[model samples]
Target: MQRKKPYLQPYWWRLLFRANGTAAWEAMGRGPLIPVPNAALTRAPLEVWADALLEEAPYELEDLHGDLLLECYAEPAVTDGTPPVYSRQVRLPGK
Candidate 1:
């Protein structure tokens, strides 16, 4: 028996918005990545933080269409050194 690795590792969270919320004007947090062991814990704080930030602005909080999304994908560790699974290949000239 072996410890199996996760196929899709948890990545960044995408906070999407509509209406008056502009994605270009916003910036993601640059602080240390807090290891939240539970997904339930992550949602409340993220939503609260987003709401608090938006509250300071002129946008109507209720009117804003927003969702906190977890972005996950297969990490490099899962793909590295695996044969045809790799996409890029070094081709010899004229071959």
Candidate 2:
């Protein structure tokens, strides 16, 4: 697990599961968080697409494994500013 790039630029996709706010029991993301290209992200309105993806995410968390009570629809990982950088993305109005 120590034989890969040591730095992540953010915006890459990953599978994350948490046991608590503290880093007591956590497995690292299986891949590097490389900076996603503008041609690879989903087009906005990001909220709509995100909600749709969230609808199909795996969120059946068990009480003995995780403790984060986030959204209940799907279980999508939150992205900071990634949806604006995806493929075929149109420019948002008003900058």
Best-fitting candidate, scored by TM-score: 2
| Global lDDT scores for all candidate models | 0.32, 0.35
Which runs of model 1 end up more than 4 angstroms from their true locations?
14-24, 28-60, 63-95
Model 2, 34-75: lDDT tens digits are: 333333333434344444443443343322344322121111
Against the true structure, candidate 2 reaches a TM-score of 0.28
Question: RMSD for each model, in Å, please?
Answer: 16.6, 15.5
Quote model 1's TM-score. 0.22
Residues forming the 10-long window of minimal summed lDDT in candidate 1: 86-95
Candidate 1: residue pairs that collide: none
**Cα deviation of 80 in candidate 2 (Å)?**
14
lDDT value for model 2: 0.35
